[model samples]
Target: MGLPWYRVHTVVLNDPGRLLSVHIMHTALVAGWAGSMALYELAVFDPSDPVLDPMWRQGMFVIPFMTRLGITNSWGGWSITGGTITNPGIWSYEGVAGAHIVFSGLCFLAAIWHWVYWDLEIFCDERTGKPSLDLPKIFGIHLFLSGVACFGFGAFHVTGLYGPGIWVSDPYGLTGRVQSVNPAWGVEGFDPFVPGGIASHHIAAGTLGILAGLFHLSVRPPQRLYKGLRMGNIETVLSSSIAAVFFAAFVVAGTMWYGSATTPIELFGPTRYQWDQGYFQQEIYRRVGAGLAENQSLSEAWSKIPEKLAFYDYIGNNPAKGGLFRAGSMDNGDGIAVGWLGHPIFRDKEGRELFVRRMPTFFETFPVVLVDGDGIVRADVPFRRAESKYSVE
Candidate 1:
């Protein structure tokens, strides 16, 4: 009473010309190009530098003329120190690995797209000398599967299971027991760099692609209907409904995964003080003040600086205990420290406080002051620790 599986196979095999259409080839090429671009982006974009900042702050780009907005608060600053001057921090292998997995999924979807297009096109039946089953009517089902595969790959990659390394060795460990592979990159806590966060956009995009494919299939007519209502029409509606249900499920599942995977780790020790706006503003004033007070040129200050302060461990250690003391030498070889009073309270004999109103050029390269050995700032100042040279090598 029902059509058997062999009949379906016979229908597909009999229509050889349908397997190679101009439209199918074009769609395959487009899908392939998209997949290639995804891989290219993953390879060239270093997450530590300015190139990857845009992706991290996805929607911040449209504010017009605020292109460098993402870099304003030193968000693009090097996460680690050591290595050559050109490479200050360790490369983010997690990001690279995640990108590769997402790209693989895209490639898989592209291949599936080709297969669906090739097999679903209308073709004459060799048995009856007429068009047999309307194969294109089932395109929605294949499209839905392709979308699911895309989402699954992205989800798997974000879990760190599919990547070269794991995000956390023991994800279920106690807060203090958990350890990140790289602490310099700050992957220890619940951060956006987690797999779920990175893969979310990819999953959303895949879901939308599936929805579009389903819509396209719904609009295409398999055969003429009686008063525009027939069994084929019912099949199209049912397929679209099933696609919608799957899409909803994916959305819910992705949300749940992200929420659970990104929960913050409660450490046994005091909370680390992350850099914030207030801290930056205070440090800026202090460094500038010291430079102006000493009348030291930037190059002069840089030359006098020691090397210990260049490493992240120097700054990141014991963040909760008042954190690292932020200060930098001015371009004019002067050192500054932020004072509580508006005017420098502890002024030199010349009435100059250890504060500067203006910042020097190349301030980022200015030496970070670990300690103020002498009460008064001077060009030949003694620093407990300093980073005079670039940490590239």
Candidate 2:
């Protein structure tokens, strides 16, 4: 049924103006989400408070180009390292939130502009006398742009080899020899930009994205292809999108759970099993407990801390073996520890000690099925060390 003149003038309906209105509404929704995220980051941010634990803390997403030039969240007050940063700018929580707010404002303005020009027939196709949009072309353009960005960052080793301030705290404070968060998956030592670790991963992904974008842009997809992909109709498209969302979700979940290289140790923190009732949080609690027990003065107890790796023996079910395993004691031919056991450390202004990050323990690092001298498997292995029943038996 056709709408009345008054209704059509005042409200949006199934007309040419509806396309413009939908665009405006979509922009507004995106703006709202960005604004909300900014607010949430602001709410959680506390400059005065210090999170001593290195494993768990608020995370920030930094641009590769900006970070490569040493523009990052170097504000040391938020973490255990307390001091003024040498090269700090709009890369911290405050800066990211502000950027989001600015983006949201721009989106809102664009939405308003679209709303004002709702009656425009710019999108109307001359042949059909109806609005038409090239969604595939737009997607291809987006992919191309994203691929270029990723390729530029990864190929140049923007964050790992070049940027010192991102992985570690206060790049200028220390010597030029800077190590990455996961050196095994990154360039190590004072080598000048050798791209092989996580950089390779990014480069591969970027290349694929670029190729996909080019294919979409140059070639007109066949009807059979659209039908095969379940994108022939709006209903099929929606269902396919839902399936894609779930598939992506499961992939991410598996990566995080298994602690794959995709979820880098530097960016997303350690795996769930490593920290969830395992060594990470346990060591932190043990240190605090020791501090409370030893010191008589209640006021000065927190300030006076225990040494790093001090209370390792006290943790776990079997205290006799201790938290760390010695490679020297073993009768193996190589007599060398294989895994990268290093973790990020938090320090004071004068480079004095504060706390050490607890990475994976000996048993977790090297999965050894203990064997007796008589070529038989030993029964007394500390498989499940912690009291928490979550760990593997």
Candidate 3:
């Protein structure tokens, strides 16, 4: 009679135990929904059949980047291609879909277990009579899991350090640039190859994350920290939320623009370009097209693609283009063009130079180092001495 649903909601909201139960139920529901959808995808996916765009395949309930195989006709839409199963440590589309199914099952079981013990007062403090979720410890668990995942991907995956041809597409080759990790500081130079550099970054980050998690789980926060952060207050939660958003934003930017993430060319295509407002893959496709037209073979096309040349030009200081700084080339306005720091200038068999690519370090952005033949490091200066006009002793 007297607004029964509102009364029921009030009752549920008031009880902390009930609230936890609701959370579990919510997780279960979401997991079940996602799992069912993923199951459908797995069931319908066929290696032999043509892979359509996810929007066309699943209509409104499309998974954004689910991997697919076979000839694709997306009708001008971007096609998401799966990794090769033959490639070592690469997870195929079907494999990931299966993993989703397993995860759903585990979530369902967890929900059921929580439901059976609905009256358990785990997340509440007996003395305070308030929700006492050990936030640091919980966060530690998440960090540990994330760290393991990142480390695993970096150490073993096809797009990581071990993946021979999949790491990067540079002037040297698809293989990563292996710089010495000796001295820990600046011994030789800091030239991180794509994919490999990305992999190493992940590995290092993962290690730090794991250690931080362990520290958090083991140690108790000081009273000063609690006071400083205004813990147990609504303001703290709001601040944390804002901080989380900014952190996520920075991470996304770094991963996409700076190549910090494990997302590989094979998985998500090349890095987005500012020229197209980061809308679609244009440059890579164009290069591939030109390569294919010239060579008339898919393998040769990929091999001949000079995407790195465009990359060099974008970064500035390319001598081949007669730019200001000579980061890659050894010549200082001289006709004799030489490569910098042993980084090779890739050329086709027809004597046409493809690219003289040299990945710049933080300091290397300004031309300070003098190199001998074959781009050997001979000497270096402190200040900016890039051009031949600014010759110094």
Candidate 4:
């Protein structure tokens, strides 16, 4: 809605006489959020504060429903290595990029909601008497700076950064080179534009951004927390709360469901938006329905499945054809371990399990075509790895 309003009608929408009200409101909201985030990043890195936990302060998110920290890995996995991004913008098992997008959308909505109730005169009008600080000057500067950073910094990262293995998604599956969070520095095969290493800079920026947000609000004098309550606020809050819950369930339940049942599709996101969990979930159901034939057992039909081997090469390696297999230690031959079947389970021909990987993708979460040693015929194995490293058992 924000993008549409701005994009489709920027001239008219931003016209001082037209949608000036909306522009001011949305701008303020964006300003507050973006400014706070930048400020939080700064404070989190304060050398004076003795809390030496460099990145995400583990166990800080004590919400009972929350699991672990909101931190995610360079790629999709339990641990965070390549660039340790913490508090990661939002919460979810769907990984970083997806979470980031969701938060962006959420903040957009919150900003929109702010304008629906209050007039644009002040950040907080309910405060007793005129406070020491001036509203126009403070919010005015904050609004400008925040807008600049959100767009400028955001563009710098998206356009200039994003190295190989930095991990992003696609309509079909995952694709990226192994790289770092810093700008343009990584393993030889990865993207030069994307630098790899400890994302301490990000940590500092994020922590300070949070602090700035709190401070900005704190400086807004005082108002009852619910001062802005209105019919629109209630309706919007209720609607958003419902949507948030549903989205959470979709990402979480979908990951567990798909990761367990079908071949796990490794997703690398700039944020949580990178996870293709929804696409694969629907595809799994569609394939399961089509695979079930009259008088044919599901198990029998499983092995007799079709292979959708799309590509035949990687940036670095040759293809693997025929029944021959290359042993890639624990990765089962994937270049950068993150293909189908996240969990590992070894098996020979037939249904018996030989050795099971701790977090096999063929778990109850997804539909499985159990491949023994002779399995993986479904792989574009000729390519560096299977469709997703998670696909292997």
Candidate 1 similarity to native, TM-score = 0.28
Could you give candidate 4's per-residue lDDT for residues 1-393 as a string of tens digits?
356542454433212223434555455565455444433333332222111121211111111111112223222222322333444433323333344445666656654565464334443235653212243234435544554454443334423353222232233333322233342223521422222222333333444554565566566533554355332232343465579779967866654433321111222111122222233334443554566745565554344432211111121112111124434221123323222222234444455554321122122233334443433433112223354543443
Tens digits of lDDT, candidate 3, 1-393: 555763454444434455556656666666666656755654543322112221222221223234311212222232233223233232443344456567767766766666566565675678986655565666678678888887665555534234332323333222222122211123222343233455466567778888888887788789899677665443454468679879988876666453332333322323323322321224454766787877677656555544433332233222123343534222223332122232243333444433322334332346445544355444444354553442324
Best by TM-score: 2
Q: Could you tell me which 10 consecutive residues in candidate 2 have the lowest summed lDDT?
A: 169-178
Q: Where does candidate 2 stray beyond 4 Å?
A: 1-51, 54-81, 116-122, 156-197, 226-232, 260-272, 275-393
Report the error of model 3 at residue 343, Å. Answer: 32
Instruction: Summarize candidate 2's per-residue lDDT along 77-148 as a digit string, tens digits.
Output: 242233455555546544654666677677667667666766566766678867555546655776788788
Residue 156 miss distance in model 4 (angstroms) = 0.9
Ranking by lDDT: 2, 3, 1, 4
Compute each candidate's TM-score over C-alphas. 0.28, 0.51, 0.45, 0.23
Error of 3 at 156 (Å): 4.5
Q: Give one digit per residue, the lDDT tens place, for model 1 in 1-393.
A: 666974443333434444333334545565455445544544443334221122222211111111111111112343212112333222232233344456556555655565565543345556666644444445566677777776664554443345322223123212111222221223433354353343554466568768966875777654565335553443454567679889988865554334333222111111123122233334444565577679986545434332211111122222222214533211112212221222222334454444322212223333322223343333322233253331211
* Model 1 Cα shift for residue 392 (angstroms): 37
